[model samples]
Target chain A: MSAMGDSGYRSLVDPEGGIVDRSIFVDDQIFNDEQEAVFTRAWLFVAHETQIPNPGDFFVSRMGTESVIVSRDRESKIHVFLNSCRHRGMKVCRYDEGNTTSFTCPYHAWQYGSDGRLLGVPQNLTLYPDLDKSQWPLVEVPQMENYKGSIWATWDADAPPFLDYLGDAKLHLDLTLDGRDGSEGGSEIIAGVHKWIIPCNWKFPAENFLGDTYHNISHESVDLIGIGPSAAAGQKGRRDADIAEYQHVWAAFEGGHGVHSALRPAELGYQPTFRDHPAVEEYYRKCFESREKRLGDAARLVPFVGTLFPNTSYHGGQPRALCVWHPHGPTSTEVWRFFLVDADAPDEVKELLRKYYMRYSGPAGMTEQDDMENWNYATAGSMGPVARRHPFNYQQSMHASSWEGPVAGQVSTQISEQNPRRYYEAWAAYMDGQSWDQIYSLGQQARGNGR
Target chain B: MNQLPRTSAFFALQAEVADVLSTEAHLLDDRQYNEWLDFLAEDIVYFVPMQRNVEVGTHAERETTREGKDMHWFEDDKWTLTKRVEQILTGVHWAEEPYSRVTHLTTNTQIVTAEPSVDDATIVEARSRFIVYQNRVEYEEYYFVGKRTDTLRRVDTEIGWELVRRDVTLDQNVLLAKNLTVFL
Candidate 1:
């Protein structure tokens, strides 16, 4: 971790002092630099595989601020390409999502196949002779990887592979993507996408999700109202009491990914989560029993929330979903959330989860609506001259951390700001143009690999 | 097109339905959330679908997300709706603490269908357009314009009608507001 201080990017981010420059949220120059340094080079979440499972299906998504089309070709190969047409600058595909034989540019009718191959040029033989069609395919992302059901892409070809970048973060992310029965990649997104705009910097939501355990106090109204899974059963909090005595871990990886997960002790087994629905409780009880049998000691890890590096975030347990905070400018974010449910889940379970997700997430959500209010006003607060001079205090429980957490990475047992500190440290490295070798702090990797 | 003559009974029903809508909007505008709950049935199903940009041919099938099966801005019931009101009443819900100045405008009112005949209708299918103007704190403002199709039931109460089911179609494909704290 000391190598991060030697990289000459420590001015904006001082981990020792645990204070960060406010310009990263409000400065135009920092925002512009981040487009190339942070978003372009990082493994950005493009789309979920379930969004475009069939051949010829496509879904328009955003990498950073630019639009990209995530398409499954007729041959069933997934590809991500810039939405711009080669001949002219017009967007080749404007409709949000639909299956199509080709993306025909509305401007000049420059047609490109679902595979992003240049298919048609109006009067190619007479208007433009000797024009090589092979040279002009729609510009595709240099690298793309589908980890489990998630699709990630990077513009920089030299960037590390997706799994390598995940490092120790994979175990926590796996908890989010896996099924309740301890199966591999059984989660599938629900039918529609929830999209909204927030007037705030992109990092506000990203850093919030990057294991900000201290922000629970801000949700005082929601916690008082008690809208958890067992809220009707005298459970008065934001989540179920199944993990009351479980060891809560705030884990941060070398590559800037971080998660807040709980390790359930074997002594506290099969706590009922849903008081209103007996079927739901029974379903989960069976899942917990089989999970213990299948994964043995590993099944103890339960997911809460996590953010994967730049802008992708997830809520694994109660309100299961994957979300992306797309950078619109220095002070705006376009958020898209894909709610997830197990593919084999009973219709009743899916229905219950859907209703829970509505009240727990998105703009209408009781819990996250309060969060958006904070983000909106906080971004406005950062733009003032005097307010910008002072940095935010992030020194809570600064030195109280263990090198090898039971989960992975730098582990904090109590409420701590170490995750955000690590997140900003890696963010400064990206801003300073450091390579993968200099970026990843591999001291914790050895412990993560022991499993 | 053939036309049916507008009868005295039809005019009476139309006026009554429009009055119910007008009263509901006023309750919200006055910040009478607790009183507004009386206008909803015990088993009311409130849904606001997320509009999507689809191919021309798929408009009927894919323009809006399915109510019970897909994700949306809102797909909740009376219990959850009551919780929203309760959360706001706590006086600490930052999204609505100061309470944004909101005015809901309902127009283009029409009675599309009537069950048990128009003359003796106890249930009616109504359609209208809404424009909600919200200004928050000091400078934030948002305009939500959309279509609303509601199932209004004629109840034997002082208000005489209650919202049995409400399905709102917010015209924008992507919601332009940060949060949907106000009721639609």
Candidate 2:
């Protein structure tokens, strides 16, 4: 294996650090290299277990560039397999989602069971009497794991265990995925997936969700329109006094994962925060009590948004939205948005949350409309020769961070680029063709150096 | 589910209904959204249900239930529709700042049910197929094809019809457009 040269790769990111070359967004060679070095080896999110609740239930999902079927077998074991035929490499199952006992290839009529075992092939005895049927099965994803109902898989057989891969990010993920006490069923993805295309590199959205509070200014129009209290207040011009009062925290974890969150003050009286609906408010109050008992002081903080390394992201609070930025190529991405709600919540609250989700974060949503336009233009501008030569700055609040909080990872204020700096550092590590062990160690060393 | 025969009276009513639909389409395609809002009844429920593929024995009941068990793309009442129109009309909506050029092609109009002797004598349920072509910026173009079920009520003799309810079901499981800023 040819490792990336220090000069060639290190030049793409600033040698002194906290700056990134624009070429990474539009370079064809770098994009192809990422498919092999990052996507194939990384643990990527596939589907939630609740999405395929029963035996034979399946959902077609994409991991990087390869399409896979996330399904449950007769014995209720979840499996992920490449949705390709063994004979000639055609997609065996074409629908986005469905339940079936077997998948039959359209072109050659080759059949495979829900367990991905080859059940039949056309003219098996006539064409080749000695051909072994046991040797042919749909290519299985090498490793799979379920954590709090969210399913994840990796093509690399040697990838670390999912929990270890999560590291301290597991604490924040549990806040959204694990719900309240004995109601361990947690949150379930609502029935539909909102998918749409964007003419931008996948990293723009992924990095934004990871930590890009600076772009909140782009959402000023949403505030002018008076959509929500948070939108109306505007994140700009907040004094250090306000930051301390709100208890705003931006924490970056190991393995490039991080969260930016702040407590929505009670005096703000945000409607979706349960101030408008008493019943829903009462339910959440108890839920928060249970969470406080479980997570201690950390439960008091409300997570606004966070990213899980390479692609998947989640936004907590009302009308919760989880997203996966599926990379199409160097210049485009296919965004899959899933809305989630607590399974135990009342039907009316669920309906209210669904409507709120459609209005705020769906493809045609008010707030997201602003984000898409910015990303689309930003990605397009990178194609210019002069533009690609310059590097983007990520030096905001670089030296201002402390580990004093009870929360895990390197902590900073809500408005800072330290999180994105950490993200690109990880990206550079992967691009350097470092092994997972090396990458893990790099994170530790960076943590020791502090933000 | 009574299918009305193609009598002269039915033919006249069908043409009038088609004209009403055409006028509404023209208003939307021309971006006369406030005028388009006037064509809707005060109690209108405009909904677009989410589509899904399921097994042979299973039914994707996104439209059948009212308890919000199933997800939908849009479930707007008159007030919500008005709010959406207000949002679009605001000059700051970046997604629509350039303003997409839209063309709505509606065809295959049929009256599914008509009861001429009732109190609301001219009330009818109609269905139509629509294909909306939307172009934004210099390079992006989107084609959205869907079938719409509508409830039309003849409000007065001078004004032909007003849409009281509409349910649009799109064919694509995953919408390929950047944003669904245009109406179906």
Candidate 3:
């Protein structure tokens, strides 16, 4: 498909360019198009494997607007199926997560096995004698894959292979998903999902995490609360302006996957405060040692926050939160956040990690409070006719740096628009109705030419 | 359903507990955060667990206690609560910049248990339904309902009751508000 086709997706985002029209955030038509084009076709994160470990364990998750049951069958195989019952379309499973051998619809006593096979229907012999039970199973997700421990599913079966879609972004994703020692078990999602609604476009959070360390200024209040490093620098005043200069890296991967990372001093290590306790500190030291051996110097730094293409993002460091910006509409997003900790961490460390996660990233989190205010206002502002006409600027540090590091893809200083530009470039590809192959080739060409 | 029988002493204790709860609610509703801190015991553990929609057969997995569970919306101690108050008083915490106007409605206050008077503190266990109505901007209003189980300790006759512990279990699994800046 041509970029400048009838969809006008080309006009929505400049082809491989930085600027983006504001209408993309507020237009209903564009939102619907994204649901069909980007969300359905792209690999969307469902749940971590640890969430549904045992047979009959299940959790209800969303793929775009459609709800799906992510479960482990009696055979202990993972399955993702639509939550809707084939009998009448009511949600077969209503719970967030639980362990059950079968799901029975509340409306009618229609039962489905853990593997999503229609098992029983109340009064089947009386109500519908000739009903074909095999033909009435819950609709299954076309493609589902587990990378490391995180589970992802896509509605489009023809989408690129999961790891191939991840590409170089997997290196960054591994820092969180896969443990340092390459242990048999990776990370585990905390007990519950910290979910809340934000009155903003989903792209704002996605793009922000992808590469907008520039927004660090907005978190000055968080620093003042003695939570951020700038707070520790006290009397010298914050060296906020030069944060990007301090060993930061940006990686733009194929398929719009990108990450902006800040390499904390190697001596400081992963979670420095944990070092205060002898046992906890020793555990971290061993982990870091293994990580350094595996990933080299890159292991020393943290991927502060980065998007796994479209909507899923992982924010590591003090309070590691795995976030999914579930788009409700063009104007609003439902953010499903899960705190992740190394499955092998000590109980005390896990407790502290959970506390840190809640304190900094949950619905009442201080850092998120600041960001939501900006995004909420930004979304509301775009509703204005005059505001929608103008394009939001993405030209910051546009040509400042090129790919010149050990990282696999396009590399830039942390405070650059290169990641967002690349993100929208991929968005434009999907929106323009291009095939996955075409999108991959376009990204490769762009990266090759250093665009 | 195993509620303590109402007696003369029980009535008096209930009245006192109701008064203390009313004052606490008033302080929170008025945004008297610093003053509200005084009502908490020195080693208070205030927490709000995240409710989940677990299936019917899985009551064991669904039941969460303060010590057993890793996930909670608010797991705060006196120190953390003080810090939260300090953050709010800085006049810069963006979520509470304009300060949410809140009304904490406490009802159905039931005394679950009461221990005999002791030298250090008198222990009292109570439960109440809480509905917090919060208004931020002119157009935005949010309501959160939960049931609270509080362990109040009357430390000596002078200070009366201080909240040693509180467990708030919200009705909604997914919070609709932008932030849970207000105390429930």
iRMSD values, candidates in order: 0.8, 2.3, 1.7
- Which sequence of candidate numbers ranks them by lDDT, best first? 1, 3, 2
Say which candidate scores most in TM-score.
1
Worst 10-residue lDDT window, candidate 3 chain A = A235-244
Q: Give the TM-score of candidate 3.
A: 0.92
Candidate 3: tens digits of C-alpha lDDT, residues B1-184: 7666677778778778878899999988888887789989999998888777765666566745245457777888785677678778877777778787889999888778888732222899889999999888767788999899999998653448899999998888778877888887
Q: Which pairs of residues clash in candidate 2, taking residues 3 or more apart in a chain or in different chains? A: none
Can you tell me the CAPRI class of model 2?
A: medium
**Against the true structure, whose DockQ is highest?**
1
Q: Is candidate 2 or candidate 3 better by lDDT?
A: 3
Model 1 TM-score on a 0 to 1 scale = 0.96
Write one digit per residue (lDDT tens) for candidate 1, span A1-451: 3222444445888777889988788888778888888888999998889989899999999999899999999999999999999987799988888899899999999999999999899999999899999999999999999988889999989988899989888988888889899999888899888889999999999999877878888888888988888888878777688877889898878878888899988677788898878999899999999889989999999998889998999987888889999999999999999989988989999998988888989999999998999999999999989988999888988877777568667888887887888888889878888788878953344235331
What residue runs in model 2 are displaced by over 4 Å at the alpha carbon? A1-8, A180-185, A227-245, A263-272, A293-296, A448-450, B53-67, B116-122, B156-160
Candidate with more favorable, higher lDDT: 1 or 2 = 1
Over 4 Å off, model 3: A1-7, A15-17, A121-132, A180-185, A228-246, A263-271, A275-278, A293-301, A447-450, B63-66, B117-121, B156-159
Q: TM-score for every candidate vs. truth?
A: 0.96, 0.91, 0.92
Each model's lDDT: 0.87, 0.76, 0.78
Residue A120 of model 1, lDDT score: 93
